[model samples]
Target: MNFDEQINKLIYDWEKHAMPVLRGVAGVNSLAAVALLIYRYGFFLTEEETADLFASFDLIFLIFGMVYLTRLLFQLDRWAFIKSTWLEGVLNLFIIIHGAVNYFFGVKLLLSLSLMFSDANPVLQYQHVLSCYLLLMVMTEVTKLSTHLSNLNIKPATTFIFSFLLLIGIGTSLLMLPASTVGPHSMKTLDALFTAVSASCVTGLAVVDTGQFFTFKGQLVILFLAQVGGIGIVSFATFFATFLSKGVGLKHQSIIQDFLSSEDLSSATQLLRRVIFLTLLIELVGTVGLFFSWSEELVFDSFGQKLFYSLFHSISAFCNAGFSLFPDGLNTSILSDDTTEFAISGMRIDIRRMYGLHMVVAALIIFGSMGFTTIEEVLSPSKIYDRVKKPWKDWRIGTKMALVSTALLLLLGTLAVFILEVDQLRHDKTIVEALITAFFQSVTTRTAGFNTMDFGSMKDSTIIIMMFLMFIGAAPGSTGGGIKCTTFYVLLLSAIGDIRGQKNIIIGRRAISPTVVRKAYSILMFATTYNVFAIFLLSITESGNTDIGILQIAFEQVSAFGTAGISMGITSDLSSWGKVIIIISMYIGRVGTLTLALALSSTVKTNSFRYPEEHVMIG
Candidate 1:
């Protein structure tokens, strides 16, 4: 045989014989990586044990390098293969270079870089890099595994619900580890589960003080959960699979379309990519903005701490997950005191206000709550270009509806809060400061869960207004949760149509579909029913506590159901059963009421024979 023919035969033989083994090995390695990471971060290891862990990590990297090299060697179109797996290729190349340098020169490249950039311990920084690399590897494996989920014959809604449950499970386990808490002992199971649900659902409610009770490692776990939960597990899995693989299968795309609320299955993958990119892009910009916006008075132990705070709050705000590093949330006295006392328009305003930081966080919250689809339509480069080319182009009806509803809610909530608390607000702060605080509260109450003023101190009327806002919550398909603004808007439109004696509900010159209107009402009814049941449960569970009233119980129930996370100083004092009830409420809220109903209810096809339609009694 010719030399070329011989090489081809050998390559084909290697692929035929070794590829399956390699795939199995890769799966094992991914699982090993996850285990190693859990051990490395989740425990307090002795010096010798730490050394052994690092050694194990290096060995894993070496195996990964060998596997990549073997695959590269057998590929006929090496360039195409490398391009398809560029991210993995780059990581593998870095691992190889780091390994070579450590072996040949007895110097760790990551440690050296850590020393150059940070004042923290070099070894610890090096471990962080390795942990991050392992995390990436784990996520890649997860995405690969997710592609096989279609074979399980589960509905897309069921898959979506299961994804969050899986995330919460993993997060709970991680948070319960010894190293995750400030105390020597691990977090209690209930607290860990509650925190995990809050983070995974992006609800931001916490039984423990996030800033004081958890170590930095624990906070990191929460951050990861919030980010993944914000974008959604399905989106992460599908995006990674599509980005790394040659292409996504039809099944993956079909599932992704439901998650993204995309009508066109062909563009589901593209929308997923855009959503992820936009999310990260917004977060990065927010981080930079927050870093600069922090008042000089607010001190950190180190630059890394400062950076982490910025990054954490940025993700939390953008996710509408109000997990804060501050003990008292945004209303922490320290944060308010950190701001400068300034004057505006000849009015001497001596009161301190978190103007810059609050505004930045509010903006992030607003953007996140607007939904990815709306964000894409408004901010995407292609859309901008199209709009520029065609000035007459209008936003989709959904976008218009979301925008209008959000604006109305924000305006109404702001005015209501301002009016209700005007005397109390003006007693302690200037008009401008009061206005800013009112605005921030309005922006956060819907879904962000941030508080500039103490909820316990607010008037009952103001609390009612906040609850109304929370009930409506954010836009559909957004990170934040509630019945959703679209649902709220649709119901309002339907009400208006009925009042006007019209057969159809119209908005933006387009008739709303009956199916959509029905779904909207279904969500509302489901949400109301759940909230009522949850409030009753909470009332029964906490009946022994004299400090807790029905108003507080009801407020807590609605907050959990809306995933708003605000509470009247009651989260930490809840009984175990109360926490469990809240946990269920958060889960139902995060996965929409309608989505859970769909997931639980089986489809029943009707016979071809028609039956007479019946009218329902009026409310």
Candidate 2:
């Protein structure tokens, strides 16, 4: 056989023979992983306690890491790990180093190594290294499991739903742990589940003040959930797996292409790589900006605390989760004393009163909500200069639609909100603050949930405006969730076409697909129906119990259905049944209304046979 044939044969042989053994190994590692995870997150363990607990089964991670490392070293014929990119190889190398140090040098070297990361807390370094090792093991096993699942011929959509359900379930369980909560009382299971759902759905709606009620471990759990859920669990797992093995298989690429809504399977791997890289890049930059914004605030207890605050908010913002470390979300100006104030340029400002911070956050939200495809079209490395110089040349219709719709929505939303709330804003704030807040509110209303002004205090007209904006949310395939700007845009074009007595809906001289328009209508109708149903349920469940009005209840339900999370200060007081309704709304909204609709549908029946069509009056 030639080189290609030989390589193919080798892969087949490995899969036919070696995979069984690897599967068994992965099964064992999964059990060990469970124990390790519990030990790490189940309780507040001291440095010595953590060390002792790790010592109990310390060899498990080491052995798995070494095995993968060996696969990289001696398996040149297999071209497994080495075939992965250099960055992945470097990461695996660190895993091997960690495993070696743990096996050979044990606690002594780990202590010395801990100094490299944190002098005051070497145990954190140890924990970080162990977490890395565990991650490597999990990724390998998960990759294998996914392959096996694909072999069993599971549908990608079904797998996607299951993966999210699994993440939410696990996150809920972890957040319910006693150590995850602060103070005397533990977090109720229902509340924990709600928070877990919100975080995993990247909805940012919470029953408790995240900074106050959730311990560091809990915050970390939420942060982890947001990241995984923002990108999607399957994409997140497979992206890391691609680094440890050969390129992603065609089947895997097909599934990921569907998940990301990419052009095709051919670009799925490259798209995933860019997605992960872009997410991290944007979050890192946001963190730096936030760090400077908060550095002058001096509210954090330590530099590490401030750094974590910045990092958490950055990730949360970019993920469009709307989670804030501040107790009142971003409305910290009213909640905290002047000590938390910061100097921007020359003027002193409260954390909540910082217009510059709001602008930075608004930028993150806009970029995040634009969707990766639109981002790639405009800002990808190859297109960056072309976009600036040529400006709209070669842009896709979707890109143009997204940009135009976003701008139009932002302008109108800002103008509407500013005009409606001018009296309220002008009472205490300057014109600049009022304008910035209006812009910020407009940017956030479409999806990102961070609120500078309290929604509870806003007028009903403003709330109605916000509800409308939230209903038509961020663009498709973005971290932000809703019916999607494209879906709404298509519906609008269809309406306009009907008014003009046109059959084919056209934009920019390009005819829109009939199928696409139909799908958009279906999505819009389904979303509206879902929101109405959810609102009815919440109204019945929370009526008379809450001090708030029906409008507020409807607002909250729409927010949940939109995955917007901009509540009118009634989320915490929601009845259990109401919470359940919101939870379902959040889940369906994040998963896509049509995705749930499809999953529930009997099957995709081909319309080979049809009865004679009869025109029916409508509108």
What TM-score number comes out for model 2?
0.89
Scanning candidate 1 in windows of ten residues, the lowest lDDT window is 342-351
Candidate 1's TM-score reads 0.90
Best by lDDT: 1
Q: Write the per-residue lDDT of candidate 1 for residues 1-111, one digit (tens) a residue.
A: 999889988898889778778778888998898899889888989989988988898878888889889989899889999998888888899989989999999988888
How well does each candidate superpose onto the true structure, as a TM-score? 0.90, 0.89
| Best prediction by TM-score | 1
Residue clash pairs of candidate 1: none
Tens-place lDDT per residue, model 2, 294-323, is 635545556787889889988888778989
lDDT of 1 at 203: 90
Q: Model 2: which residue pairs collide?
A: none
